[model samples]
Target: MQTKINKVELRNLEFDDYKELKNSMVESYPEMVGSYWREHHIEKLLSIFPEGQLVILVDGKVVGSALSLIVNENLVDKNHNYSDITGKYTFSTHNPKGDVLYGIDIFIHPNYRGLRLGRRLYDARKELCEQLNLKAIVFAGRIPNYGQHAATLTPKVYIEKVKRKELHDSVLSFQLSNDFHVIRVMKNYLEGDTDSKEFAVLLEWNNIYYDESPKLINLEKSVIRLGLVQWQMRQLNNLEALFEQCEFFVDVVSGYGSDFALFPELFAAPLMADYNHLSEADAIRELAKHSEPIRKRFQELAISYNINIITGSMPYLEKGTLYNVGFLCKRDGTSEMYSKIHVTPNEVQHWGMTGGSKIRTFDTDCGKIGIMICYDVEFPELSRLMADEGMNILFVPFLTDTQNAYTRVKHCAQARAIENECYVAIAGCVGNLPKVNNMDIQYAQSAVFTPSDFAFPSNGIKAEATTNTEMTLIVDVDLDLLKELHEHGSVRILKDRRKDLYEIKKINT
Candidate 1:
């Protein structure tokens, strides 16, 4: 019944024992910083920070400590900060926003754990930033190599086991859990890793005012990769395994260099799966609940990967009717939603889904891309509209029925790619999905295709997943080729179209 006691005070690491701080981390993790990298980190910090700037504190004499610095020095050269010319302007000093605080080290001692000491450290940093009038705070963490969680569930069982013992969670989780928003996941930062594979999180304390429509600067030009967090429909019964598999598919696709990503229609279907047996009106109401989380997660993924993501269709509730819609999200948090304009007759009459009114295009770091949902893609005119606007890539997220039917759809996709002279990506649900009629139907052959050239032309099929299989099909599309074909050619696919002749023939028949 006596009062609990604890001693906590903030102090600078300069006047304190550095070995004690270093030992705290090393003891918990022998190689918290590997032998070769430990010296490099210490040297780097010393070179940049002044003696008193590296703040550390003794929480009851060795409970926790942190190392931080204010990055007020001019960046080495705007261009050197990025891999491309555009970045020179994007990260330039022209930004009125001021300096940033960067945390170099944060570790809690084993003896005094579970006292929310880490949060206190973060609070101290936040207060320091506010007091100093800093514009932002940023830090780097380990790349969550959460491979094991995804291992037993994916096709890479053997490869996954080899990395089972690697530690990857501590730093990244601390940053994210403490309200730090991740800005980018860097490469080759961690020793022994060939690529820049570190997670960079930022906590912006000032209002950022920038115009010219900010785009992902593509700071690191490695093949663009995508990340798809599983789309879960909250109401479905026993879909945990399916969603887990779906997430594994996303990981595989990301690993394959597909810079942009999209999920199948109604990724929130699982959340609304329980309503599969409900009345159409009731189901629509239940489905609306899934939009916010889906948008937020997709936004996070886009920001994390520095890529574009098309959120597969979800039911957007507005003015009382559900609109089957897809959202095109960019790296900086701006997105445009495309509604399914050409809803199937069944969808309109039976399910009461409304058709969208317009066609839209998304301009990305990669290039301009368009979307046409399931039945919407069947309308040649719908795709033609995007072509007329000079879209280079077309994405189709469908929930189709049979493999044979899907083959026809695939052929349509190929024809669309050839005719529009653009890349066509078709993503579909592979396994059984709960239907409105109380039956589950398995979808077929989800694939990505491009116009073929003389060597493989018919733009070769990039990748495809089998009917009734749960997997992601990813490919690096060369948009430049699509641009070339559209510019000059023996065959001008869109330009050569015989629309008038087709109408004449139809009338004659």
Candidate 2:
């Protein structure tokens, strides 16, 4: 009487499926004739806890069902019996304030047996447990075939045999394969049952992903505050002086309770003063030699101030090649480096630096973030790819020497914020370095930008600094609000992106 199902759909149990559920239960568990759930019982369970009820439909016909209820663990301790936990098969012990999920029953039609339908139902229950943040799922599984050995062996001995793989019970074997471990055997779990001589196996599946800590819900409290310093370029007498200047900014920003502080690209150019006797290209090469010490100092500052620092851009030399790389020093004394992906003509022709090929995003405790140096943000495809990878914030560090160069970076940064629906923070180097070559006559303005919508500020600017000024602008960004706007905004740009018509695919080299 087996029926081959062509199409299968899984959905939450509705009132209209009560009759089908009753029929399916009866057909699936014929041994429990009087134990079959009535239609009214199904309706009552759905009305009270609909999220825990689910059904599997095969070509518009109900073929399987899984039902669960929430319960407090304190009420059902380690030694509690099944009848007391579920209230005599009526689920009167269901608790809305419970942290654990209690599995009441699951059945698939006899004709649809061996189709892996039961596995799908179990997976759905696991997913529901995660969404509700439940602690674990507990159930009493019947060992139907244990009745045959009841005359010679006790329930404990039978379960041991099954665990050792010397014996197989239909229900216990299936549950074990699905990651449910047996706690112990329960006597008189189901009255008048032929299975296990009226005994059942207590099983549980723990939710490993459950977080006991409270979630970040308050917008203000959940905000990640950033202090952006538009560093002023100047003549430096020595490396010690340059380090002292950097520490001054960090000390000031740390007092304001900022979680992260950002600096401009090539802000360390003044450190190249020690090598001014060499050519412009040789000077950058000399700066690259101090990359290790520079990174070590940034890491120490990050740990000392208890703040994450973005060390703008440094001339990094590796394997006989020079690169314009930015370093992110985390508060935990760790760091990550991102090489500039789009090198400007000045970088390639004058500094002998090449562009990086790979685009990457960093995973932090606050949120997922991406770093694109100056010219990189101008390319729309790069930011879009990063947004696709769940980046909520994009940091741009620039070192523009002219108003026109600064405008190009600023406009493209704003456009990226709109197209990707993400926060964009731009910081640049300012002031004039008269004695330093290729670093003099800087023009810059730093800003924190947001998406253009009703939920955001009217001007889309969270905070901005005065043009060509040496200042640090602090701003707080709400990650939860960003998520809400992405889903229910005035215009859903991330959702409306036409992937079918066109997509920005990264070609692996």
Worst 10 residues of 2 by lDDT: 213-222
Tens-digit lDDT track for model 1 on 54-86? 333454455466666655425421212212211
Q: Which pairs of residues clash in candidate 2, taking residues 3 or more apart in a chain or in different chains?
A: none
Q: What lDDT is reached at residue 201 by model 1?
A: 27
TM-score of 2: 0.62
Model 2: residue 419 alpha-carbon error in angstroms: 1.2
Return the lDDT, model 2, position 132: 89
RMSD of 1: 22.3
Off by over 4 Å in 1: 1-252, 434-439, 455-460, 497-509
Estimated TM-score for each candidate: 0.50, 0.62
Least lDDT summed over 10 consecutive residues: which range in candidate 1?
Answer: 77-86
lDDT agreement with native, every candidate? 0.58, 0.87
